[model samples]
Target: MSATERGESKIRIRPMEPMDIDRVLAIDSKITGVRRAATYTDLIIGDLGKIPDLSFVAEVDGEVQGFLLARRDYFGEPFSEEGMIHILGVEPDYWRQGIATRMVDALAETCQEKKLNAVRIMIDERDDQLQSLFERSGFRRGKLVDYTKKFKK
Candidate 1:
């Protein structure tokens, strides 16, 4: 079977709650090699917890193995009120088990119900693996530049 194909593992995709923040942080930290507790706490679990449809967590046998955080709002011209995926993380041990894709599928279902025709995500250009994952989940590159500037205290 292919990596994208489901195996004996049955992943349950459900709306993410604030309670799932700890597991989400652990999975993210393991994958990225950096703990981002503040970002997840301040932005995701704090804010998106109230609006749960666009955010989701994947579970296998009642344990969280992955998460996908997204929001549907004005993402500018040609795709107003569309969805924007902020983060997708899966435990290293669960990689290539179709967990991440299932979470994305869950979000897609919610977007369809909410009448959101588009879902967008911006990944770091250096992250080829992430780009491939999104592509397999039906994402394509967009014509936009990510200009950035750092501010110091």
Candidate 2:
């Protein structure tokens, strides 16, 4: 059996709530290579809590399976509402069940409602499945580079 065959259903995607932070962070840590601080909850909640209009979660049997987080921003131009998807993840156990696709659809709906011109996602080069999902959801590749710098203690 392949990895895709192993990751079958048993998951669902829905709007995110303040209470889903912990489980979401666990999933985030597994998907991304970041050591999240204990205060990660407070930080994600603080940024997304008030703006419920821009975030979502994926759950299964009352547990958070994944999450998609977006923020309102523009490309350094006028006040245009461009949404950026900062993170998207589906637990390894539930990889190919369309959970992440659903989350992206939800975000796209929200962006449409807000009259945003475009929604952007920076996918990890290694995440082929996720890149395919984004492509199916009407996101095309952009001619830009995504850069990041981490601070050390």
Candidate 3:
């Protein structure tokens, strides 16, 4: 269903601005246990290869309630470009409100506009809610198992 089909509450979805970095950081920390607000800014600027308008925010009442980071990339050998859902978070208070689905739709539209081959996402094993959302967005688990390593400096 479209956002319009889901009723209207003045939800404004738009690209992220410098002013949104702080709230985006807070939301990221709350959802992911990552607290690198400074590094996030740098990574966004120096790495990520993200287009300015593809990273977005969902707002209501003039406050940011959600954010989405989408990017397009190529594997070393693959001669094709694919889209990635690098990060997405909706404020805890706004859970189960379809904010995520809306963000996914927006990201998909952006990817299509840019002629991406496909959009992919990686979700943590424990986040059932987000997993459900991904499924609702037509994403299925691929053949790969998710792995990560933690290091301390």
Off by over 4 Å in 3: 1-8, 30-53, 145-153
Question: What is candidate 2's lDDT per residue for 79-144, written digit by digit as tens?
Answer: 556888876678887776787888888889888888888888777889887788899988998877
Between the candidate structures 1 and 3, which one is better when assessed by lDDT? 1
User: Order the candidates by TM-score, highest first — what do you get?
Assistant: 1, 3, 2
In model 2, where do residues sit more than 4 Å from their true spots?
A: 1-12, 32-53, 124-127, 145-153
Which regions of candidate 1 are displaced past 4 Å? 1-6, 34-42, 47-53, 77-79
TM-score of each: 0.79, 0.71, 0.72
Best by lDDT: 1
- lDDT (C-alpha, whole model) for all candidates: 0.78, 0.74, 0.75
Candidate 1 matches the true fold with a TM-score of 0.79
**Candidate 1 residue-wise lDDT, 1-153, digit = tens:** 643344666679998877887788778777766665565534665644463348889988789988888887786566478787888888877887778888887887788789887788888899998888889878889987888898998
Query: Whose TM-score is greatest here?
Result: 1
Worst 10 residues of 1 by lDDT: 44-53
Q: What global local distance difference test value does model 2 have?
A: 0.74
Model 2 scores worst on lDDT over the 10 consecutive residues at 36-45
What lDDT is reached at residue 83 by model 2? 89
lDDT of 3 by residue, 38-132 (tens): 54534663445444456888997678989887667764354668777777888886777788888888888778889887788877879998788
